[model samples]
Target: MLINDGLVRARGVRYATASRFAKPEPLAWDGARPSERGPACPQPPSALAALVGNSVEGLSFDERCQVLSVTAPADASGLPVMVWFHGGAYVTGSGESTKYEASLLASEGVVVVSVSYRLGVFGYLRDNLGLLDQLTALRWVRDNITAFGGDPANVTAFGQSAGGDSVYALMLVDTENLFHRAILQSAPLGTRSPERAEMTAALRSSISVDESTSVEDALAAQTAAVTEVGPKFPPSGGMPFAPVLDDVDLTAAASRVELLVGHTADDGSPYVPSREHWEAVTELIFAGGARELARDWAAACGQVATYTFRWAPADAPLGSCHCMELPFLFDPDGWRGAGMLAGQEPDPVLAGTMRSLWAGFARNGMDALPSRSLEFGG
Candidate 1:
């Protein structure tokens, strides 16, 4: 399992199993060592494929995609663990995507675990199965990550976009303290979960599909449902498959976890066709939402930190847009096909600084922060 740069990788490790539309059950030992990256949850093409490259290209898909990948230094012991949940509006993207390979972060002296959960109708149509899948994965890590040299108690749950939202959501439900710190990048809080009545109506649109339906028919039904319901939730309504909002006290849960959350300078740029529209979207959705969360967390607890990544490749049209910071956190080469990078790799010094800051946070929580608010590039 040892790979380049002295890192040991355990790919396609099954953490849990679930039947269609059911909550996941944790699996401690599957009787077989995982060697290949498991299939991603079946999903349609990403809406952001033109911005970030199509991550699912050439990747396999299945309903049973509750797997995680681990990468750690060959000699690692008791290292801080950073568990990643990829972002694709909770519809697409997988932890096994090359764009998410953790060699760079692993080389930075921490253990990284990338997770893949169910997506789309299979995950969110009638139940919060995907989020439950994440909780199940966390439980698996708590019970077994020690074998991979990660400190179960020193875990940092971090993600971007929907994945970032997933991390923020996890803070409210992680009553067992599975992770002590969180990093949320470009989480679109402006599009909060719809009211239960609204969600119920939306779910009704896909009532024709069920556990026995063919995957193609299910996906078609999901698309039809979203098309019918999207207009009701304007602006960010294009995203309907979201975490179901719970009755937890946001202030209390956010206060307990050390948090570092923020968005890119142009996070909404990729969604709009022009600079003006993009600017408006960025402020209304990404920037404003993250700033509001940071303010609320700071008022409730003193352990919150925030940041803004403003760096973009020179002349890049999507300047510092969503997913821009990912190249710095992982291997830039992995994102070579992404249009957002403009054929330019992330600056090495900046990438190093970002990685160090992230790894340090995993190691020491908010105390590792250089400041309460930080700006990178531009």
Candidate 2:
């Protein structure tokens, strides 16, 4: 184990294996082994680097990226588990990013797992292979997290942006009781995923890239495909690759677990040029979708909590945009150079409270949540 600051950290724990553009199959592991950090799925530079900084700065890229990292308190047992999914609109981002180190969250008496799944044409092109990678990771946690002091039955799946979108999708498809609760941070639920017809056409554009294609060529094809077909989807065109919304009934899924879901107060600020544009995008792509999901789940008898993160440096330009709350939930040093934080320190009290609330939710579900419609950094 890679012990750090009294935490037993296991990095690059492979949970599944897959061929290029194929479905992921679960892999067995002998729990708690030391390994190198997994390479992120191959992709282009993050489109949001100007706003959130380069999260994957030093990471290598590879096709076999179905891996995860686990961090837990040393000499602990029976602790709650928090599985994380990093966000990048299904095209970018990796859970192995330094920006997502979970030491702070783990210090709160929980085990944290950060997942790295396939991305772009390598993942979402043929099918939901990236999501299947997540399912395999959850199964791995169920069977092996006990060795690292996590309670298998009390797993909580949490994510942000595309990652958050992923958690919501997992809630709908999870059948093995893989997780009992979910925390969806800034999930863009209002962004419509491409239908089958659209996906098929997009798939056709990247059809030339197979197992033998150079990684660079494959990425180029992925970009070309998006460029060719993205305009049809308009506002969500930049994020053309997303989880396909199939005919899954949410009523059953909704009733199975408690959920905490919401977005930042100015989630669209970084993406838009004006306050009016920010309001439109924030509502249409973030707030509206989040509120709808909470309402639907609650109406279906599911326990739900929501929040609006309004925290930002006093002179920061983005004003609590998407990803602003992340620094509060993870190790401060990891975000030391993050543009999203605006070079100012996150308030220690606020960071501690965010960690406590998230860990509390992992341990006690809805009971850990404050009253609904809570506002942070207001």
Candidate that would win on lDDT: 2
For candidate 1, write residues 1-378 as lDDT tens digits: 546678888888899888898888888765354668778999888888888888876678889999999999888899999999999988899998888988888887899999999998888776678999999888888888888789998999999999998997888877888888899999988777444347545666655877799998888887777777776776546567877866646676665688899999999898889999999989887888888888887777647888999998999988899999999998877788788888887899999999999999999987788798999999
Superposed model 1: Cα runs more than 4 Å off:
30-33, 193-200
lDDT of each: 0.85, 0.86
TM-score, cand. 1? 0.96
Query: What does the lDDT read for residue 335 in candidate 2?
Result: 76
**How much lDDT does candidate 2 score?**
0.86
Q: How do the predictions measure up, each by TM-score?
A: 0.96, 0.96
Q: After superposition, how far is residue 265 of candidate 1 from its true place, in Å?
A: 0.5
- Per residue, candidate 2 scores C-alpha lDDT tens digits across 1-378 of 688789998888889889887889888896647657888998898878977788888888888999899999998799999999999989898998888989889999999999999988888877778888999999999999999999998999999999998998899889888999999999988775434447546666655787898999988988887877776666567477766767757788777788999899999888878989998999988999899899888989888999888888988877888898998998878778677777898898998998999999899988787877677886
lDDT comparing candidate 1 with the true structure: 0.85
